[model samples]
Target: MSKILVLGAAGKIARHAIHQFLGQEGVILTLYLRKSGRLQKLAGDSVEVIEGDVTDTRHLQEVARGQDVVYANLAGDNIEEQAKSVVEALEAAGVGRLIWISTLGIYDEVPGAFGRWNHEMLDDGYLEPYSAAAKVIESSKLDYTIVRPAWLTDKDEVDYELTQKGEPFKGTEVSRQSVADLVVKLAQDPTRDVRASVGINKPGTDGDKPSWY
Candidate 1:
């Protein structure tokens, strides 16, 4: 069985990924979140629910033991610290693969007017730390894929496409479901995109800003 540990399990994308994982056979999940009660209902045959902070390296190391993969769906001003903790914990636990959710423009790879708009919206306090966190993951020896998603939406569909690190980010918005789908695919095939950063977006949605903006 493939054992997966999901950090920040209470998050929307993580929840969607968890559901997709549960639909597959030969997969087991350990859902780790700050508030265990939020995902208590998921505890069952193929799932384990645990309360923990990803920033607590010792606790995260203990929780990460024996897992095949760690999917981090986390955010906050302290995200860089959390990334460091995750790397330390995974190395200590001997876990070799990680899937991290980040945002577009962390690499300044968005182009045209949209790029400037993205920086304006995220530059104040968000993008810098996220970029730092991505750096932490990239510098580690562990196999990692940092997923930088375009503006997020709650739409139920899963139509999305991928862009590599150096390529300009495409489109303006993608559904949470699409991000979750990519997460699930990476977990299922550990060798798919090792040590690479991927950008995800809905095709044909390109604009100066997301539609809602």
Candidate 2:
């Protein structure tokens, strides 16, 4: 059984991931969110709900105990700090597997007009913190796979592709379901993409920006 702790459990992508794990054999979910009330019903019988902020090291470590995998789906200006706190808590708890969510532009992996448009659209507020968080996770001793997705959409489709850290990132928009499916894959098999930062997007969606933009 995989004991998975999902930080930012109430988040869009995280919600999709939670649903993906439901009814699956040997999968137990711990939903950790600042406001978990909204997610209580979603937890069902296979989930343990914890209400708290990801930046709280004490709470993070407490919940992180015995977790086979830690998946963080967090955002905000303090994302760098939040990622640092998670890494520290996991280290303190001796947990080694982490599936961290990041954005495609965090590593300047996008190219051409898309790259320019992605940066201009996100600016520093989004790019800076996310990139900073990715750096923290990459340098950690933990076995981590940082999954960077392109512009996310509310669409439910699961079509997606992988772009290695050094490879040029593709696509302009991908469904939240697509990103969550990757998380499910990584968490189910800890050794799948260890110590790598990968980019994900729907194949053939590449353009100046996402279709919605």
Report, for every candidate in turn, its global Cα lDDT versus the true structure.
0.96, 0.90
- The C-alpha RMSD of each candidate to the native structure, in angstroms, is 0.6, 1.1
Query: Residue by residue across 64-106, what tens digits does model 1's lDDT show?
Result: 9999999999999999999999999999999999999999999
- Once superposed on the true structure, which residue ranges of model 2 sit more than 4 Å away at CA? 43-45
The model with the greatest lDDT is: 1
The residue-by-residue lDDT of candidate 2 on 1-213, one tens digit each, is 789999998889998998898858988899999887888886666789989998889889999999999999998899999999999999999999999998888878889999999889888588988888999999899999999988888886889999999999998988999999999999988789999998999999978878876
Tell me the TM-score of model 2.
0.97
Candidate 2 weakest ten by summed lDDT = 38-47
Instruction: List TM-score per model, in order.
Output: 0.99, 0.97
After superposing candidate 1 on the true structure, give the runs of residues whose Cα lies further than 4 Å from its correct spot: none
Q: Which residue pairs show backbone clashes in model 1?
A: none
